[model samples]
Target chain A: GAGVSQSPRYKVAKRGQDVALRCDPISGHVSLFWYQQALGQGPEFLTYFQNEAQLDKSGLPSDRFFAERPEGSVSTLKIQRTQQEDSAVYLCASSESGRSYNEQFFGPGTRLTVL
Target chain B: GESVGLHLPTLSVQEGDNSIINCAYSNSASDYFIWYKQESGKGPQFIIDIRSNMDKRQGQRVTVLLNKTVKHLSLQIAATQPGDSAVYFCAERGKGAQKLVFGQGTRLTINP
Candidate 1:
């Protein structure tokens, strides 16, 4: 794909169910980011990955949220024991360089609904 | 107090009219600012970027103006068209990490 791609455009999970969201960044991109967006709010940074390293997880809200990028190309964000507040859109973005200033391309995002 | 838009600020202009969207950031050390457009059901797409060094930067049909003193930013779109209708967001990257703090956003509705 010419741009970033994500999986499970829509998901419905029970309050205690676990869900995993996938992100395939643009080929050769060195920076990958995950953000969580609530209804009518802008995306909030969750984590940042530089290649295969999880450089920043300071934005992760709780222990239930975890993300990994072992190969440096693709990443996964997992949420365990989801709660109603977990219902929001998860957005993935990638940049060519792992620098401080770079243009990021985003995916369609996954809309998660917790019941 | 948390920053949330009580009502989405809207800009309605006729086709071909130039449009300006404004944003106010709180962080003082922000050195990088970016403008993104997000359509319904889609994530934000990078439109243009501006560094704090210069006050103004221009792209194809867009111009970004940054004022560090007042912590204000604005995106100016030239020759607005129906296809340009979307929500615009301004983000600031603070010192250290590249995490962006986005604004409340303004809805641009190009009336044809």
Candidate 2:
């Protein structure tokens, strides 16, 4: 079975530019999550979606970070006015259900480099 | 203020030897813990998980031990192989929380 997939494995952006990262979760997965991982650090949760509903966005660092899963299958994370501090790998994951105990299948993240 | 942290930044073990990675979490409300392995240029891969109610759980060659009283967790891998060389992370999910708090990660090197 195909696992989660993300686009633009690497991206370079100028300061103040906006960037968008996409994620395709596994087929029939009901839960999706986004996380940000800085260099040499573990991933930190960014947002979560259960189907098309955006349940939690607490981990998003700032208002510039926005995410949506409008169709319930694909999700996107967008950062406005990118900054050096926003440079990190954005990871996407999905699980069979919304329960915390379920194993989350992750995708090869998109590494964003802000200059 | 809540965070998961690793005691060691790196660990090196010989091939066929066992390896242990330790983690400490500050949140006492954490009820679910998971271990993940990550290679260069990839996302974290789910290794194993254990709940607070259970003291230990095993899967394949990996075992996860959770000590709620001490707010500690550990992951043990038997017969470490070259393929096991990567960064390992411990994550915790607090009760009623949807997000997972991850540790800094411990780099494991397997010397053959």
Candidate 3:
């Protein structure tokens, strides 16, 4: 009955600092995804996971962005050397299946502000 | 170089009137389309979705139309209400692709 949840709803960091955001997907979800949304713009895909396997990471902006879903239930997104361009809302979503047609339930998202 | 884009940045309509939001996708290979609604301080919520094989799909108070030949998509809301005010986004998934490409959102304002 619980929806996807993210930790540290808002985060502020100085330039060059490292930050990690957490996401708790719904129970029994097989597919998880991460996205970055800039202000007034649509969300952009970052990565995807299926049962703890990192299947797609093509959308990661650079080497600084890394994600993991070690146990297949919870996922973490890490950003190293935070840059002003990285300031945006990071959203987490999970679906019942790994198929592209399934609807994804999204989390409230973590807003990261780099100064 | 292909992307999903909206025709308008904002749309205002009176309560009880119908509202329409349009989107254009450059990728003809896109096979799945979805519409999402988002409010301030919240994540996107799925409204409805349609596959490329279907031309239209209907949900509670909302309908989605897809024109594969032209790569156009539209969301129609019946009896628009104040609670329907939010930013609407159209997303597409190319055939066999695992990722969704989202379009610029349309801000819907309901004047009650």
Candidate 4:
């Protein structure tokens, strides 16, 4: 079975540029999640979706960070006007259900570098 | 604000020996806890998880122990192998919460 996968495994964006990171979760997964990880740090929750509905966006740092999972499958995390602070690895995870008990399978992640 | 933290930033253990990593969480309301192992350039991989109701859970060579009284969690890996070398994180989810609160992480090194 294919695990969660992210595209543009490595992205180098100039400051003030816009970047879009994509994630494809495991087939039939009902819950998807996004997280941001800084160097030598654990991943921080960014957003969550159950199907096509955006359930939680509380972890999003600012308005520049937006995510969409339209049609309930592929997800995109877009950062507008990327800043130096936006440089980090963006991780995507999926689980079989929305319940917290299920294990979350994670993608390799997109390493975004803001120059 | 809720936070999860590990006691040690790194640990080194000889191969075939048992290894233990500890984490402390501030949120007593957290009802679910999980451990993850992440290799360089890769996302976190789930290791084991324990609910608030149970104090311990085991999977293969890994064991997770939770102490609700002290808000502590520990992961024990028996007969540690080189493949076990990676950064380990402890994450907690509060009741009815969809997001996971993660700790800084502890790097484990398995020595030959």
Candidate 5:
């Protein structure tokens, strides 16, 4: 079975530029999550989706960070006007259900570098 | 705001030795806890989890113990192998919460 997969594993964006990170969760997964991890730090929650509906976005750091899972499968995390402070590894995870008890399978993550 | 934190930033252990990693959380409302292992350049991989109701849970070569009284959690790995070398994190999920709060990770180094 394929685990969660993310595209553009490495991204280098100029300051003020916009970037989009994509994630493809395993087939039939009903819950999807996004996280941001800084150097030598654990991943922090960013957003969560159950199917196509984004039920939680409270963890999003700012307005520049936006995520969408329109079709209930593929998800995209967009950072508008990327800043140096936004540089980090963006991770995607998925689970069989939206329940907190379900184990989340994670993708390798997209490493974003702001220059 | 409540947060989860580790007592140590790093731990070095020899192969075949048992290892214990500790974490402290500030939120008593958190009802679920999980441990994750992350290798370099990769996302976290789930290892084990325990609910607040149970004080302990055991997995293959791994044990997770929860102390609701002190808001503490610990992960014990028996006969640690080189593959076990990675950054470990403890995450907490409050009741009815959809997201998990992760603590600063503890890096485990294995000596062959």
Candidate 6:
């Protein structure tokens, strides 16, 4: 793809319902990341994957939030039993390498509204 | 929590004025830093980047300044236009997974 792409730009889920967001990274991107951005706040890291291996997920916020990047290409962030507090924009980014100095391209983001 | 531009610094400049936005990061081990421009209801667009070893780097219409001693970073935009009006953010990459930690951000409003 030309850039990191996300699906279903906006989502409205009921409490206790499950919602899934997808990400398709640029071709040959080795590192992928997910973040959550609350209203009037900066984006916070959620999880990281390097070529299909989940490395750092310490920032997932809770057990209900999970992300996976299988085959090092596409990724998915699934939230189980969504809560009202979970309403926010979920962002996905991809970088060419797993190095720190590399630039991570970001997607448009999925705005999840938990009602 | 540590904040970047908690009150949202405002920069109202003429269309051709050169705008400078500053940021202060806490970590010293952060080698990767980037400037992002986010418009309303859109994703962040990369502006420019600078490595830890370098103090300054320039792009098409943007420049980034890094001061390791004070952990400060600044972005200089040349010939600001109305389209440049947006919130700018500076992000630092983590140690292991290289996850990005973003600053609070500064809102730039270019006056016509």
TM-score versus the correct structure, for each prediction: 0.94, 0.98, 0.99, 0.99, 0.98, 0.94
Model 4: per-residue Cα lDDT over A46-97, one tens digit each: 9999999999999999999999999999999999999999999999999999
Tens-digit lDDT track of model 2 for A3-110: 999998999999999999999999999999999999999999999999999999999999999999999999999999999999999999999999777888999999
Clashing pairs in 2: none
Give the DockQ (C-alpha) for candidate 3. 0.83
Candidate 2: regions farther than 4 A off: none
Q: Runs in model 3 with CA error above 4 Å?
A: none
How far out, in Å, is residue B99 in model 4? 1.0
lDDT of candidate 1?
Answer: 0.88
DockQ of 6: 0.69
A1-115: candidate 3 lDDT, tens digit per residue: 8999999999999999999999999999999999999999999999999999999999999999999999999999999999999999999999999877999999999999999
List candidate 5 stretches off by more than 4 Å: none
Model 2 per-residue lDDT tens digits across residues B1-112: 9999999999999999999999999999898999999999988999999888899999999999998888999999999999999999999998877788999999999999
Native-referenced DockQ of model 1:
0.72
* Docking level of model 4: high
Instruction: Return the lDDT, model 6, position A46.
Output: 94
* Better by DockQ, candidate 6 or 1: 1
Candidate 6: residue A62 lDDT (0-100):
91
* CA lDDT of each prediction against the hidden true structure: 0.88, 0.95, 0.96, 0.96, 0.96, 0.87
| CA shift of A86, model 6, Å | 0.8
Could you tell me which 10 consecutive residues in candidate 6 chain B have the lowest summed lDDT?
A: B1-10
| lDDT tens per residue, model 5, A40-87 | 888899999999999999999999999999999999999999999999
Summarize candidate 5's per-residue lDDT along B31-108 as a digit string, tens digits.
999999999988899999999999999999999999998999999999999999999999999998878899999999
